[model samples]
Target chain A: MFPFRVPGAAPIRPHGRAADEVGRLRRPFAVVVYLQSRDPAHVKAVERRTMDKPTHLIEFETMLLGRHLQLSAPRLRRNNQSLDRSAYTLLSRIRMEGPMSIGQLSEAFGLDASTLNRQTAAMLRAGLVERIPDPEGGIARKFRITEEGGRGLDAERSANISGLEKVMAAWEPEEVAAFAAYLKRLNTDIENLDGRPWPRP
Target chain B: MFPFRVPGAAPIRPHGRAADEVGRLRRPFAVVVYLQSRDPAHVKAVERRTMDKPTHLIEFETMLLGRHLQLSAPRLRRNNQSLDRSAYTLLSRIRMEGPMSIGQLSEAFGLDASTLNRQTAAMLRAGLVERIPDPEGGIARKFRITEEGGRGLDAERSANISGLEKVMAAWEPEEVAAFAAYLKRLNTDIENLDGRPWPRP
Candidate 1:
């Protein structure tokens, strides 16, 4: 799923739950008898139709997911653990990759320099991050996560995990792990295509 | 995954990909043999430790996924076919469940009446939806998709599908279907928990 594999990254394999879901959805629709004919055109048409389906479903489900996030995220914020999403993500990036200048953040996140400047300024005002002279003595200042920032990110992350745990309460551990792996893969591929790979722990 | 299954909803089975990834993550660390000994304390300790892991990964990756969406969604808007996301989703809901009043949308999405009012008002201005007297002659006016809205939704949806196709270009059909199923299940569960229960087509 990732363009460059981590040296010892875990491998994700296909599982049966998805097969069962897909199979059940298909069974009520039609019974397919594979064509024994050697006609390439007929085979190609069938392949094309099959290929179109999953992608379509993925597109629709993701749209709904965005809606789900819209609804759930606000509810999550009623907890004192709430950290605005951009701030949380920015803190996470700094936590993972250490302090970085706005320019570096812009490059890593594909954001405009102005946007990063505004975002970092907000982080500074919120005490989530503080500016420091470059550790390597570069002219540009870098933003570093403060202890407060770390606590806030950790707290918000814990809340998020708790929410997911509630959602997946009935899932088997293997199912939870597999779904996570798939999400990681999907994000990695998106990062890969955008040429802005996010660092993983 | 859902509190209530649709009359004939497909069943999602747990598949191997997740197990493989989880197993690999466990390897290079330690191996455990299930103790035949009847010590409940040891068994409980092992179970607790095992339970804590994958949930953490899922939480972190989901946060990262949010970051990716922030980065990618704007780029997606550059297309002429672009429809604002809320507008697309609103049109889609109306398309699926038929035109609905502000109260119904608020209930279904858990949004404040003021928020849905503002959203529908904007959607009205954009010509993506129109106000109609409730078909049942109810006093509350409902929003219905315009033909233009339908066209915009379809165009944006196709673009979304194309983008996902690029992301999953190397994925097997089964993998794509499974991931979609996972997403569907996840969203359904979230909706169920929220008591929103988004209609599925």
Candidate 2:
């Protein structure tokens, strides 16, 4: 049986003649048949089909990620670097892409200008980013990552990756690769649907 | 070339004599060699090693997820249901696990009791949850999801799931499963490291 039921498929009859037959055959032949059918390719296909129909898992992932962020918010600061995870991320973005106008940042991050303004303001106060004339000669000023900000971002990134490495230490290398590929793909698709959050440098 | 560069490795000599050699190899042989070397198992291992060493991708995932949540937050309300994503998730927990005391909710969510208190108070004001006597004879009043809350939750869940489906429409079923599984594992590990939020029913 598949791990997840198909979304609108007929409900499995729990106590019918079919069920009785399944129960009776459960010990030997059924086990043999199940094992025989579960070759690597077959198992992969089945797992794929099971994941295709339901939105529950995706929704659950979103909820869990949100909660994880909330749970970790307080601990985001480290070693006198007062920037939170979002701030650190912003700094990293600027570092990677060079200076960007607030409007451009808002577009890339899918956030309101006001929210970005507040966040950037706080970052400015901390000297993590500074406004500079747009190199492209645009009217709007651009924000660039400061040297201090670069160090802070490096610290936070190292810490986060170290934490992930520990959590994933027991996983197979293949599993880690699949997970990373899938996550990257998911983000790519999301960016396609919305707007690209991180333009390649 | 791998999708991600290995951390601490020397940068790809993009403009060196080696670059000229690689460029001279041209399309067919170079493409064939690249494809052959990217066997599923080999690629998976490479990806795993890359992810293990770099915090950039992990940090990017975190930032993307956080931004996605913020982007989706304003759309959570519909009709007369005004619950935010966090509130909807909280109500769903109550619905799934039965009535829970504020203290229990706090512990489960890894949040301060005062935060839960304020959130629950808002839920009460919205009539999404109601105070009830704890069935287990606990002194603190427990919170139960109201019928209206259930309906609101259903609406919000459907909307969120629909959005995810659209965003993920182009993804392979295998990709979806891998992403979901990885996300779940990540959350479980995070919970273990910190404190479990949302006990199993």
lDDT against the true structure, per candidate, is 0.72, 0.66
Compared with the true structure, what per-residue lDDT tens digits does model 2 show for residues B1-201? 433333444423322324333333333333233334536566445333333433345556766667667564343324434468679779978888999998888877877888898999999999899999998898999999999899888888777777778877876544565577788887777767665644543
Best TM-score among the predictions, by candidate number: 1
Give DockQ: model 1. 0.41
Per-residue lDDT of candidate 2, residues A1-201 (tens digit):
433333444423322324333333223333333334536566345334333444568787768778776555444334444458579768877888889998988877767899899999999999889899999999999998889888888776667666666666676545655666676776666777665645643
How does each model score on TM-score? 0.78, 0.70
TM-score of chain A of 2: 0.68
Candidate 1 residue-wise lDDT, A97-146, digit = tens: 99999889999988999998998999899999999999999999999999
**Real contacts recovered, all predictions:** 0.72, 0.44
